[model samples]
Target chain A: MLTINDLARPGLEPVNLEISAGEIVAIMGPSGAGKSLLLRAISDLDPNTGMVMLGGRAREAMPAPTWRKEVGYLPAEPGWWAETVGEHFQNWPSQQDSLATLGMPGDCGDWPISRLSTGERQRLGLVRLLEGVPQVLLLDEPTSGLDADTVESTERLIRDYIGTQRCCLWVTHDDAQAGRMATRCLRIEAGRLAEPTS
Target chain B: MSYITLDYADLAIAASLVLISGGASLVLRLDIERRLLIATLRMVVQLVLVGLVLKALFANVSPLWTGLAVVVMLAVAGREILARQSRPLAGFWAYGLGVSTMAVASTLVTVFALTTQVAPDPWYHPQYALPLFGMVLGNTMTGISLGLDTLVTSLTRERAAVEAKLTLGATIHEAMRPNARQALRTGLMPTVNAMAATGVVALPGMMTGQILSGVEPVEAVKYQILVMFLIAGGTGLGAILAVLAATWRLSDPRHRLRLDRLAASRD
Candidate 1:
């Protein structure tokens, strides 16, 4: 299970939540509603005061790299560092399954990052995140740039990955996507998170 | 053969050359005539003052005087480094890192050269020590400031990419490797180019000065070569130290990018 207790940062109210195994929790909010900040706090990306535990292991107990490895956070517009797609991945061949499921071409890895379209970068970013098989995934509008068909495939890929062991906190503005993917949906306004009224 | 001494009248002839450029600026409406004149005046006054100070120091030849000169050089270099940056670190680090790195690098290299190679009656002889320290400090200051400016700017521009790497479980050092490499290259490029172009493209100022002072051509060449090597070592060491230290300060122990430590841009 992934647990957040009283997690707080500037511009974000204190939050307490728990996501057990095989759970997909969708977070919906208007722009600048601190949805991304909440995810970043859980992933320990931004400076925040929080007690986060993954499978009962405290986030602060381990090295940051180790914590981040197990709890991956993918931004809305993922960043690419290297010249080519393959360079960013540890073993491109090993990520073939994830890449194929996301409908990425076999030669996608050879393409330069600059040449890749927005949707392509988003899909590749997803594939890159799943390569590590993090126990908790913090995805920020992971499919905001994808076409309808690609979105379905991307959603299916994530569902398949989150089968029974992992949990995900997906931030999206799409209500339909929230209905389709989330086991529980929550809303955030300003910096405060609110439980579903229903 | 003795070197010819230039009196005040001889200097006036050289000073007249500035008027040619100043007059051109006025004609072209470049509006830089005043700035050019002020800069020329400042250079004259500063160099003349230093020349007078050196005359006194050379006569006295005390370690305490040499130490004071070294301190002043380092302080000025530190201020220059801070001023040269578009976005320097906030607070003490802005001055402390560059100043300390240059102080250590230049002093170590200068002292090593003076003691092992150019041993005068006293190793701290102001004539030898001051000039060597000044040259090394000046070059190192340039290298460090350039390296730091490039480093802070690159980090700001590439924040997303660096943070992305950090999110992917890369250590801080691993995340910073590419940027650091670029900054170090920028810092060391000038010295490398100067070394490459020393004989063919340009006679270095030190060699030219020594030659004008009637040192044998071969002897001046040897001294210039030694000075070049010392400068390269000092510059490289100072740049590496400064770049690494600044990188460390820009991040946290949790491997997070602490860009908040950078001061607001002046312009």
Candidate 2:
């Protein structure tokens, strides 16, 4: 289970959230509803006035590297920093597993990330972090770029992966995507969590 | 060497020119106007005062005074570089110490060990040591700034990526590898560019000064080569030292980038 309390933003109330083990908790909200901010807080990308506990221990208590490794975050847009695909994997083996799981052939290791189509980059980013095998996965708009067909493929892939892993918190804007991807759905208005009636 | 006198008229003109330009700059950039104005005022006053002091220092002919003067200049330049370049004054002393060591060791190696001996003449001679030391310190200051700027920018931007890597069991160096490489290349660029343009487009300051003072063009050219060598050496020493300095102070024992000490202003 992943538990986040008071995550993101000051002066606003502390956000409380939980995604049970082996369940997909889909988060839906309007623009700037702290959706992506949630992913960052879990990964310790930006400091938030709150606590993130993955598994049992408080994430803040352990070093951030340990927390991030245990809980992977895939931002909406992938490949923000590294220029090439090979560059992304700095002599690490998890890279090989991620590339393979994303239906990429072995030689994809040599491919430059810029050459990858949008779907490929997004898929690789998710799979790459998963190769690290974090117990909790934080995915933000994992399929925003692809067409309907690719979206289905990504959703199925994530569902299958979560069945094997502990949990995944998926963020999306589309109602249909949330229903398709999430076992339980939620919405945030302004900055407060609304009941996931849908 | 033929001596050129600095007349009172030269001093007065330089002062007036500095005041007009310097005062206008102060009025225009007011938010951090104090920094610019004080730095400009300090530069003008310090250069002229140092020039006069050097003249007296040379006349007095004391190695102790000359050595002490260089040490003072190195300390001041090191402090300014560490302070002016980046934030987190907490790490300033560590950085200052590292840069100062390179500046002194490199200057001594160039003046005493490398130069052809005119022993007594070389000791307090503003002609030989001051200019060489100035070049090394100036480049070291710039190098450290560029290096620090690159590292800090990368640290903030790639904080997530770095954390990701570290969790993957990469050690601190492995985690910081990409950022470190980026900063190292950016820091090394100025010296590389100077090397590329050394002879063709640019007439370097020291060589130009020598040629203006009636030294033969070929003779000036020889000194230019030596000076260029010294500059490259200084760059290597400063860049290596800066990376080492930043590595220790930039992170906590937990190996996390500490933003508490980093200045709010990106520049």
Candidate 3:
């Protein structure tokens, strides 16, 4: 289980929550309501006064890199460092399946980042994040810029990934998408998180 | 081997060069006549003030006066660095870091040169120490500002990508490695170009000054070479320190990028 205790950051009210193994929690809020900031705080990317524990291991107990590896976050606009897409993932066995499921060609790995469209980059970024095998996924508007077909495929891919004893906290502004993906829903307004509703 | 001395009349003749340039601009309708004149006047006034201060300083060389002058120069240089930065640190750290780096690096390099290379009579000889300090400190200040500015700019521009990397299990150092390298390169470019263009393209200011002051060409070249090396050392040290210090300040103990600490640069 992932447990957050009274997490509070600037421009964000204190929040307490929990997600058991294999749970998918969708967070919805108005723009600038600290949705993204809350995800950042839970991932320990921003300064926050609270305790976050995954499976009873405190986020602060381990080294930051180690903690981040287990609790992966896919930002809205992903960062690609290397010239080629293949450079991001290193010898992961699931690469073929991930690419194929996302409707990306096998040759997509060798393609230059400059050639990839925003949608392609977004899908590829998900593939890159999943190859790391994170225990908890903190997704920030994962399907914002993608087309309808790609969005459905991406949602399917996320659902499949979280099916195997992992968890996720997805931030989205769309009410329909939230209802479709979330096992439980939480809303944020004016910096406060409301109680979860099934 | 004495060189010609320029009196007030000769100085007036040399001032004609500015009028020539300004007149050309005016005749061509380039619209820079006023700016050109103002810039020329500022340069002349500033140089004259510096010359007067140096004359008094060289007349009575004492540690107290020398130190005071160095401190004042550092303050001015620190402000210049702060002003040039688009994304300065939120508070005094913006100026403090640059000043401290320049001060530490320039002082060390200058003292080392004095003790080992120049070896003037009293060691704190204003003539040698002050000029060397000025050269080293000035270069170091520029290098540090460039380094700091580049790092901050990159951090702000690539915030998403950097955060993505951080969330992917990369340490703060790992995430910022590329930016740090680029910042170092940017900082070192000016000194590297100076080194490359020194003898062939143009005579450096120090060598030209020495030659005009009746020093042998070979002797002047030797001094110029020494100054260049000292400057390179000071600049490199200041640049590296500035980047490292910036990296440290912009992150937290938990290895998170503290973007709040940065003030958006007013470019």
Candidate 4:
């Protein structure tokens, strides 16, 4: 379970939320809303005042890297550092199955990052995030660049991965996707969270 | 062999050569004549003042005087390092890190050479110690400033990649390792190339000055080689120290990239 209490930063309102084990929470908002900032604050990537607890353990209880490992964040447009895709992954052999599920070829690991298309990068980014097996996933527009067919497969893969022990906070602009994936959906407007009227 | 002393008339001839360029710039309306004149004037005044001070220092030969000169040089070099940065560290760290690293590296190397290699009647002899320290400090200052500028700028440019690594559970050190390595390499490249090209493509200024003053070619070559090695050591050490300290400062203990610590770029 992931619990946030009074999470606040400049330009962002205090946000309190809880996601139990095996639940998916979709966050929707208009452009310029603080959806991304909320995710970053929860990941402890940005400076904000809040209390975040994962599985009865406080975010500040352990070192940041340890906390980040447990709470993996997949940015909307993920960044790649190394020359080849394989260099970024810790255990290449173990991730092969996950890569295959994302429709990536076996030799895709050896391909240069410059050569990977946007859809390919998005899928591979998801595969990389799952490599850590994070208990809480913070996904920012995870399927923004995917085509219809790839999006369905990707959503199914994410649903299968969120087993009995894991929870997810997904940010999306598509209302249909939120309806399809989220156990509960909330909307953010100008840094404040509210229930969707519709 | 004895060398002829250059008087005011000889210096006047050299000054005229600069006048030629300044005159050309004036004719073409290049607009640099004023800056050139001011720069020339400043160089003459500064060198003359340094010459007088060195004469006094040589005569007195006290460690206190030598130490004072060293302190002034290091302070100036530190300020220069901060000034050269496009985006320096905010607050005292802008000056503190570069100045301290240069002081430690240059002093250590110069003292090592003075005690072990060039032992005068007194190890603290200003004639030996001051010149050695000046040369080491000057080169080390350039190296450190270059290293620091590169490290900070590169980290800022690669902020996303670094944050991605951090979020992937990499420690700050691990995330910054590549940029630090690149900065260190940039800082050391000039010294390394100078060492490679010495005696072939160019004659070093110190060796040329010594030869003009009647030092033997072989003896001058040996001194030049020693100075070159000392400079390389000081520059390498200073650059490494600066890059490491900067990397540490740019991040927090939680491994977050604290870009807010950098001053905003004026441009």
Number of the top lDDT candidate: 1
Total backbone collisions for each predicted model: 0, 3, 2, 0
Candidate 1 lDDT by residue in tens digits, B61-92: 99999999999989999999998999999999
lDDT of 2 by residue, B34-58 (tens): 6756887798788889879889887
DockQ of all candidate complexes: 0.80, 0.17, 0.81, 0.74
Per-residue error for A187 in candidate 3, Å, reads 1.2
Ranking by DockQ: 3, 1, 4, 2
Compute the DockQ of candidate 4: 0.74
Output the lDDT of residue A136, model 4.
88
For model 2, residues A44-160, the per-residue Cα lDDT tens digits are 655467777876799768876677778777877664346656566545454655455456666776677668887887877776676677788788888887777767767877787
lDDT of 4 at B11: 99
TM-score of 2: 0.67
lDDT of 1 at B35: 99
Worst 10 residues of 3 chain B by lDDT: B258-267
Order the candidates by TM-score, highest first: 1, 3, 4, 2
Give the least accurate 10-residue stretch of model 1 chain A, judged by summed lDDT. A96-105
Model 2, residue B134: C-alpha shift (Å): 1.3
Question: In model 2 chain B, which range of ten residues has the least summed lDDT?
Answer: B113-122
lDDT of 1 by residue, A1-198 (tens): 998899999989999999999999999989998999998888787789979999999999999999999999999988889899999898898888778788888877789999999888888988888888798899999999999998999999999889999999999999999999999999989999989687
Q: Considering lDDT, where higher is better, how would the candidates rank from best to worst?
A: 1, 4, 3, 2
> Which clashing pairs does model 4 show?
none
Q: What fraction of the correct interface contacts does each predicted structure contain?
A: 0.69, 0.17, 0.81, 0.62
Candidate 2 CAPRI grade: incorrect
lDDT of 4 by residue, A1-198 (tens): 999999999879999998999999999999789999999898888788989999889999999999999999988878889999999898987887777777789887789999989889888888888888888899999999988988898999999999778999999999999999999999999999988898
Q: What is the TM-score of each candidate against the true structure?
A: 0.96, 0.67, 0.95, 0.94
